[model samples]
Target chain A: MDFVQENSLAVFGPDGASNPIHVRDTIRKGLWTSHTSGLADGHVQGNVVILPEVLASDFLRFCQRNPKPCPVLAVSEPGQFTLPSLGKGIDIRSDVPLYRIWRHGEMSEEVADIASLWRSDLVTFVLGCSFSFESALIEAGIRLRHVEEGKNVAMFRTNVQTEPAGPFGGPMVVTMRPMPAADVIRAVQVTSRFPNVHGAPVHIGDPAFIGIADLAHPDYGDAVALMPGEIPVFWACGVTPQSAILNAQPAFCITHAPGCMLVTDLLNHQLASF
Target chain B: MDFVQENSLAVFGPDGASNPIHVRDTIRKGLWTSHTSGLADGHVQGNVVILPEVLASDFLRFCQRNPKPCPVLAVSEPGQFTLPSLGKGIDIRSDVPLYRIWRHGEMSEEVADIASLWRSDLVTFVLGCSFSFESALIEAGIRLRHVEEGKNVAMFRTNVQTEPAGPFGGPMVVTMRPMPAADVIRAVQVTSRFPNVHGAPVHIGDPAFIGIADLAHPDYGDAVALMPGEIPVFWACGVTPQSAILNAQPAFCITHAPGCMLVTDLLNHQLASF
Candidate 1:
């Protein structure tokens, strides 16, 4: 099956048939290894960041200092993989379908599971992912073109600088959505309810204002076409932590491969601060 | 004593001890008739509107249709003059310090109390005022120019239209505040906590985009100078409902005089949906 059909079949069916924990379990057992854009309809998906205990405190401070992009959802104790705070049975090592292995801040390869690489000093940090807010946006009746097209949402690195913490410091990375101004307001109101995910847009008008010179040339993800009358709205992205980790260039670090998120049993609606 | 000083003494001091009920009782009496700003810290101050029951349903429909500007905090029973749902011992006829009487859309007079003009056919609507969000802004450490300059907030007519309901139909009216882009984000996050009170900004950046030709020439309230690098942010003002009332040209209506407001027993923080 194609990527779209494969990902679609994993979710998009009946309500109770597929849950977040079940999706994670399927991923853990090597039965599924694909992008999680549309999977686990009503649960929270998290961005994973694992590091040695020595560098964990600095990363914690980094997320605390810059919350818009690096919204920390749950942090695990040293050597522990289960994030009980996020859900009842969440194992950091194998829950996410794909894991990225990095050495000296450079990605070496993507693996199905990190059970072999797990060390006693490894500390896992689950950061809020944009999927939570995207769920909210769709529920508000706002049409997201990327979802319809079955494409990866466009992401870019901007000149906006995040407040630095210890060794973790870098430019803010953001995800872009082309939306009409009217829908933009509704998007802001809807996303603002989910602060655990990236809260409202940081910049709305000209891309140049935030140092993005061209909309067509995105630094990271695939560039999507902007329809006429649709302004580019940017939100701080969880990829920022990944960028920071790459910059920090630690001896060893692990992150969930893009499109392979840690699915938790927590309901998305439960994340609404309101 | 001057108006500000007299009202300030009642709510201000080292302790800042004026409770919402205490402030409402003082306003109900003839002792206080000044603006209720900064009084009863952490309590909600509502925009008052009284109309005959004949127009009550239409106005209620109007508020329902256009929730951003007319967030219904409390709606009184027909002709009851008491809003027990909002607070204890709260009488709409006497709780507000000053009332403006409008006849056929024209301002006829201002009075301390509407007891003499009370009618069983009247209905009271207490709207979530900007004061609640403004308090949130102040608490977030964003400076409001009008509050800092001791002037009324600037308000203007916008080209944007509210969803129409029966006889209540008119262009949206908005309040403006100038702030640096950084503070604008802070302001958005702060005000978003109180959706009942005009919530987040409706527009930002250029005033001309909203059809206002000049920043200094507002349709109502005082115009404060815009400082360097400051952008004018607009919020759906409660005055839109008043303008809608004027358009309908109701035979008789009452509202809190400009600056003067209805002090409620509900704490401002309690109105935060989050």
Candidate 2:
């Protein structure tokens, strides 16, 4: 499938199908099986995690304890595949562009759809991603380097530990963006309004303070160059929850592949607390 | 006069006179004459710039062009000493605790009352100060070091130039606050709400980028200590306009002495843009 052509048709082409439902429809039909960034520009894209009913409550508690990294956008009922709250027809089994099957803290396989592997006791959780707040920052005229470079933001594992809940515990993960001093202040103001999507930065300047020693080498994603006048700004990343879930080592679990998120009907502006 | 005892009585003592009116009345009656920092805790304080009517419009234009530095809160009609717009009975001539009489770009005298110097051609311009935003930052649980040490905020003249209107143009002045990385982010958000009082920080990180050679020495105000892990955040200061006026060498001008301000009936929270 030509993912770029499908995204263009859904977002800005003659079809003008810019809504999330159309994006999800394309993903559901297996016509687009790639990263979901910039497909639904102003809509909220979420991180997906599926666990058995027995372990759902503990994960929910973990999300509550550390909300900055794992803001809960929607939770599906046991054995339910449709998320009525997020959209009209969001099928948890096949709406996502890609899914990863996990077994005992290890990734087993990457598949386009998870309908055949869906079980009766599975529950889905959608966590807020940084795409919404990043859109806000860009709209406010602060240029993000990763977006300009056409690469994923740099993510790092920090020594700062998250509050443990039951069997879920690990070091918090953070995303870094280097910006000039003036834009850094404006970025803080713009992102602070969207509390549901990892609002405001956790650490800025001197990555060593957050236990990340090197800016050139990140734990995940490609790192862009940091200019002389620019200082690195860090935010609590959605990857933190995924790392915790992996550490918990549930017998059978499923998650959306990195950068392949679930597009929801909720607008980015709708998540702003102010 | 015992300024400390008067401030205590007006703010926290048994007198229980914490209102702006009480503070103004004490100043008007010649009982208190000093900096009005901690008095009237939640009200707005203004920087005063009185000029002849011939130069008033140009000054207004200068303020409009460079709002971040000279945020005009209220302007008085020519020959009018009582500012009904700011408060019920704000006698501009005698309300402020201290006044500076300037002649030909030099300070001629320091007086407590300016009633004898009032002229029919004089126009009073009340510009917003940083006190309102500082109060908001402190209230939001961010510690300000200068406030804790009972010293003045550090001020420096930067290389950044202001938009010139007529003969009013000079190097922009900025106030510096050194804080940890987290508090720096919070301070940006807190101060961003008060647009009338220097909205957000103009610069952060390196002081040399803004043309300040030494952090230990400042052009105005007392220098506060910057800790090892702290970074300096800079905001556009009200002193920019005063410096411009002095450079223009206006024949007859008056201004409130440093740290002495005009207390208004408006509350600090009322100035929030959100």
Candidate 3:
């Protein structure tokens, strides 16, 4: 595919995946409000977490405590939404395709823009998502069953408890991908190079070892069929914060709606640990 | 102090930290068989290790098992000394100012060059040293006590065991740096960005936690006096491979003499994790 078209000045690909600026511009103008799976192909797509100032420090600590599950990409100052470190003119209020508002740990509503809901005491945390590593896997010629089947990754809530920071404590949620034995080793090495995006697999082979009773059924997202000679490899998922928030029962918070993310200017390779 | 001298083309002042090419050229000609500290100021300096191919895989695995303590920068093919990835026109046999040959796990002699001893079955491993992160700390306005006192960083043999691979197994070695209370956090953040040269401190504040008994006594290197407000911060040291080899007792090996290293074309900042 021609990654960039000569005439358009924008990268042209399937579903306009070439230009991150154009994707964000469309998102900012309210013209696009969908999952950013195929858009801005190589740029980082973040899982957003916005919480009150009182809970911000603890959440930051929580992320630090569980780096593999919650690798932080960028954090914004209180009441400040222009995250210039992540992109050129990213106004967090409108850049994310969709936002979910949580009130007292309850999911209240999903909206296109969060400008009306922006509060002076809110702090934003942009966390790395699996899309970054998936891009790397694809580039490395490792076939992802989830992407090939056009299904959301199978995520399961495990008995593997996370190191709690304040009230943020819950079982870690992980997404599973089934691959052959040889790819398992390569997957670990490749993912370790990208610690910012959940470095390395948390578990490989058996789902039962981590308290998951069934590989055919998952807590969230659809299950892709495990092929012959393929073993299930699990990675700490970004949805973990959502799981922790539900248990912690914070007064108020915001997150990107499932699959709808804040696409940043940082290329996927830029997030590599090396 | 003037970091660079006005009249000298070489990074002026104190021994004049010159270009890496110039330093390498001088070393290759059998002159300048001294410690490489303060030479090639901004470039990456490496811990040299050469072992037979039979033990090479195990040593590589050992380094991976203990990344913080033994971060491998590059590994050369059997009998291959030209590490093109690390620098230009680099002939490993002559580029390093000094070489120490170990026979039956005992240091037999320190030599200016090892071309005569080089064998077809030998493989080279360039492990990262602390100079990369120390340079970063200096840039960040963090004063290193060892550097200020003109002494080597204090190194300790800790009870903290390394994950063994094959015959390579031993207690990890750590280096200590003392900094004021406020700089400890900044130091962690700074060093974490340079994982190649021992990322974020293994421990901070207390010495007893990692099994070190006395702050005044260290296993290797001269100890620097800890200032009143400064607390000891410890990092996994590159001396670990030497420790491992000592315990493993390989028949033969070659390493750079302490403080003498293989300086490469790679800039220190190029090793940053970010």
Candidate 4:
């Protein structure tokens, strides 16, 4: 675990971690180089995707065709690092805790910042993540297994194909959560309010119906125990776009590192459609 | 099927059946004596329970404690047969299409009009029914199997117990609807908006978890087919309060017959909490 200096922590009080701007400032200064999971409670953290202007139009069309998996929260113009709509002084190059550099569908390196690699024709897309809805579920008294076990949510590449745009199209990716039967209904209601963050689940109950062969052997992330009376609920994941992008194999692209997201000024509750 | 006279139908146009006042007036004239399903399409229909003033307080408390199963829509004062709050000049004695007279738990007779049995001490209670939510679900494009087959919804007595008040205590009764995995999520969201009408489902997935052994053998109502790739979703039924009242064995009581209900002026969309 990465630790912040005691003197810096004193400036924002004990609950400074809950402040989105403060958390972004810490990342800007290179003091926080890890995942932004627990930091900035109640604020929206987005999945970052930066691609060249040439591929931006095609990728935007792909996201439009598949809004459930790749809901666009904000998009920055080519060569512009600032996303004014999401927050103040949001530098797409440095605000994200860590960045993954991709070369022709393959990740080549991970770095603290992409400032040196920034290009004049690069456009940044900020997509909604499931963290916001997970917070709402927890507040509604629904306990999530992955959060309890402190593990990455189990994600799977399903047989359901995404609507294609140019070279970006692949099987949809989904995050699974095991919950009690009663909580499953509440989870649906709670998550339905956040349409920008995948909204309600695409499929529930039977995993085989969605082409998932085994619960224990997930395509990505660590698998958690599915208790005796619990049923697995699935949501369209932000990782879906990453999968589509990788399949397209663009010459040069960048995305936030797994678990490391771009913290935004938007409140989680503000995303509720109701 | 009982048909309205052609002359009477002409007076209200082709959509006379969708008008609540016309439906009630037809019931008042003894022109319709069967179940009230499919009549007054966009209006709210309620499960009627009439008891002596001595038992009204206890029954009210039972509904308050177990709101999801017995959501109280309106309650009439002692000796009051009219429910002005529900509609104009709505008389409880003859508004329902059919009524069952219960004596010490066992129903003695089914009658179209209860004018002869009206007592000054009788108090009427109108509880929200699932018909309101079902209308909302269908409008959202989720196909219901029982509705498609034109059969009564399958109901069962679950091991799950309702909160007790006075002599009212018994196992909860649930209405089961088998829908495709995707519709199940939409059903949860659609029904959640109408908390007055059973709200969200109580249990989903395995029936044995809720103590039901066979889907083919329902305790009440007609059993519908559960197709492949579809999962059974359970919602608390309006029959729950009736079951509780039967277990209590009130010396004298009256309730709307199985499918017959009290049609009200309240529009179905008005019940949405959102």
Candidate 5:
């Protein structure tokens, strides 16, 4: 593990949820760089996607065409790093704990700060992440195996095709969480309350139905064992844009590193459509 | 056929849409005393429940607890006959084409107008109906077999229990529509967009899962056949509140008779949370 991972885990201990604003404030000043998974409770965490203005419109269309996998929370003005709408003074260039640099859709480097790389032509989009709804599920007493085991949630690339927009065309990527049949319905009802995040399960039951052959081997993230009577519930993942970005092969792009997120001041309840 | 069924069907052509405002206007002027099904096009239709202010608070809790089936669109002030929020000039006392008077939950009489029975302490609740989302499903090109065969959609009294509110507790009732598997997903997605009108589906596939023993037999409305390769889709029905009302056995309550509804000026689009 690197310093980013170590620092993230340090600030994400059991008692790290005192104040999300202060936690984020520390991260922006380079005092912290880590995964944001368990850092803040009840606040909205976002998957960051930064691209050149030239590719911004096409990416926006990609999100619109495939809303389930790419629900947009807030889009920042071109060349502007501050996302006051999502937080008081969230700096997109360095607020996220870690960022992955992509050159022509291929990840080139992972860094704690993007302030040096920030350019006048860059645009930032804060897309809704599963973390928002995961908190809701946990509060509803639905056990999340990944979180319990302290591992990244399991994700897979599915044969399920995404709606094409401009040059952004690729298969949808989904994350899996195992739950009993009865809890599945409750999970649907709870998650449906937060549409800004991935609303409801895109697919449930046998993974083969969605063209996923093996449960033990996930394309990304850590795989947890599925207990008896538990079925894998698949949801449209924020990682979907990564697949789209890879397919579109933009000249330059930046995204939050896996497990690292942009913690916004927006409350999870505020995102509920109801 | 009885006068209500004969008149309701007669008011609508084989393929024509019956406008809600026109139907309400006709009923308000004593021109009709029939069910309002098949009569609203692109308008919000509601299940009417009129109760005295004494029992209104408990009923409100019932609706809030069971939103899927009893989504409250608009609640009227005590003794008020007009719902300014739902329509341009909807008179709760007469906007419905027909109304049923229930004495202690038992059917007393069917009347064209409720003005004669109106009391100063009555409070009206307008609960959303499946018609709103059904229209959406059909518009999305999902074929509804019962509609094609010119029969009322099949509805069943399920063994699934609703969250009990003070004096208002009963089994859930669901409406069924059979469609291909692809359409079932589309139905979920489309209906999920309109939470105000019995949104999405409560149950799908095997009816036995939700404790419905037989598909060909339903407790309310006419039975429709399910063709091979078609799966039954169940939605939270407006009948749920009526069932609760019957369970509570509220004295001197009024509701729209089966197939009869209160049409409002609110457009269906206004109900889409997305």
Candidate 6:
């Protein structure tokens, strides 16, 4: 919670949706620095990844080879913080809700602004997150257990291998959702439209199939309730890039804090396959 | 309506879903000949195409090249009467409810069974049909105008060109559905999951954008209501193959008459992208 001010008023009126730029506007002015899960409804919220120019090409190739886990919503030129394609005006250096400074293999600090850390050789990558598809699923009346329980989704490291590109290769990470057997099919249908996000579930029904032995114990995030008769569905998690980065242990990088994300001007509907 | 005995009871149990074998049994005995819709609930229904060996390769290529227009669910070996892949005991000649027989590029007769017309050189192809995705859409609570009005979905020829394979190339045909702005997104999401069928829409919004001149006057099927504020959404239609068959004018061929399809043991949920 390191943002400047609470300006939910400027972004959203009685209609309940604000221009995505307003959300960025608040963040740019240092008014807000928190999780952007529901801000600027119908717009894209993304996972942030910043790395030195040397590692950028391989990371981009890794994203291209493993799109389900690392869909590139926007990528910045070397040392350039402005992602003009994602919005009319985007200053990537300080637009995200929060930033995590990674030195070697460990997180060093949680910061609200990254202007002082911005370097001429740093490249930024914005990967699509699951929020866009989740909105679509909710609209279709398919209940998400974690959303209802108000907990972070359960995530597990899977045996499913990612297509390797240089030092960016690692086992895929996936987020889990528990739903009735009937809703699983509908969930797949709704999420498949937003490939820019995670697209469709990588595995469904049995957690064992993806090498998760226990539903109650997830490697990351809180384990939501998995009621009887409900199957645990898994989608390639955005944390996969973090996992890869951790294994590769790049010299220096910056990413959004765990729950915090970068909100962009692009509409969720615009990411749809149709 | 022209097949044999009326045995919807043997196929569907009291709860409405029966073993797919039962549906095939009734068809094998010449006991059921009407449209297979609603029978064998949760099972797959496929569009059938039978052509001589000389034309099979080209047709197969066409299906592969244009999966959205003609998704191949199952294909039989040349002169093969039994589609063992689709079911346990399926005699392609008689399992279908009814079929249209063609000779020298012209339709010769609409008959109850193709047993009298089965040929050793004939090749059978079972294509994924719209019914699979349509069932998923309705179950997700997306209202369809054609399904509500009890009329066939309105279809039109589009300027979108199909990938040509030998003589199988033709203008793609698309089915239209009208819905308010809100449901349009959900419909696009729902249909995208069933790529084995005609996955996701090829076009949304104005029909003219895809070369359709009149939504009121469709080239095939009946047009339903297009209310104010509702934009017309279009999906690649399965009828593209039928249109190709008519234009290619193969010397001899057989297809399930429009609306009648081969019901199989595969569940509709099995086609989901997850």
Residue B101 deviation, candidate 3, in Å? 47
For all predicted structures, in order, the TM-scores are 0.52, 0.51, 0.53, 0.51, 0.54, 0.52
Cα RMSD of all models vs. native, in order, equals: 20.4, 21.4, 21.3, 21.4, 17.6, 13.0
Q: What's the true lDDT of residue A170 in model 3?
A: 92
User: Candidate 4 has which clashing residue pairs, if any?
Assistant: none
Candidate 5 structure quality by residue, lDDT tens digits, B1-274: 1227445444444434466666677778866677665566788888899998777756765775577898877666668898876877788888887788999879999888889899998988898888888788888999888788877878898889987656887988999999889999999889888977988799989999999999888887778888899999999888888889988988889988777788888778877765
Q: After superposition, how far is residue A273 of candidate 6 from its true place, in Å?
A: 6.3
Better of 2 and 3 by lDDT: 2
Evaluate model 3 with DockQ and give the value.
0.02
- Candidate 3 TM-score to native: 0.53
- State the lDDT at B231 in candidate 3: 91
Which segments of model 2 are wrong by more than 4 Å?
A: A1-274, B1-17
Local distance difference test, each candidate: 0.82, 0.85, 0.83, 0.85, 0.81, 0.82
**lDDT tens string, model 2, B1-274?**
1123234354333555468888898889876777787778899999999999778756765775577899877766678897775787999999998889999999999898999999998888899999999999989998999889977788999999997766789999999999999998998888877767998899999999999999899888889989999999999999999999999999999999887899999999997755
Report the C-alpha lDDT of model 3 over B1-274, residue by residue, as the tens digit. Answer: 0011122233233445467877788788866777788888899999999998778756765765577898777777677888877899999888887788898889899888999998998888899999999999999999998898877889998889987766988888999999898999899888878887988899888898899999899988887788898899999998888889978888999988887889899999987755
A129-201 per-residue lDDT for model 1 (tens digits) = 8889998899999999887887678888899998665588889999999989899999988887886798888
TM-score of chain B of 1: 0.93
- Clash totals for all candidate models: 1, 0, 1, 0, 1, 7
Q: What is the DockQ of each candidate?
A: 0.01, 0.01, 0.02, 0.01, 0.02, 0.08
Chain A alone, model 4, TM-score?
0.94
Stretches of candidate 3 above 4 Å error?
Answer: A1-17, B1-274
- The lowest-lDDT stretch of 10 consecutive residues in candidate 2 chain A is A1-10
C-alpha lDDT of residue A96 in model 2: 93
* Candidate 4 steric clashes: 0
Residue pairs with backbone atoms closer than 3 Å in model 2 (clashes): none
B-chain TM-scores per prediction: 0.93, 0.94, 0.93, 0.94, 0.93, 0.92
> Model 1: residues >4 Å from true position, as ranges?
A1-17, B1-274
Estimate the TM-score for candidate 1.
Answer: 0.52
Worst 10 residues of 1 chain B by lDDT: B1-10
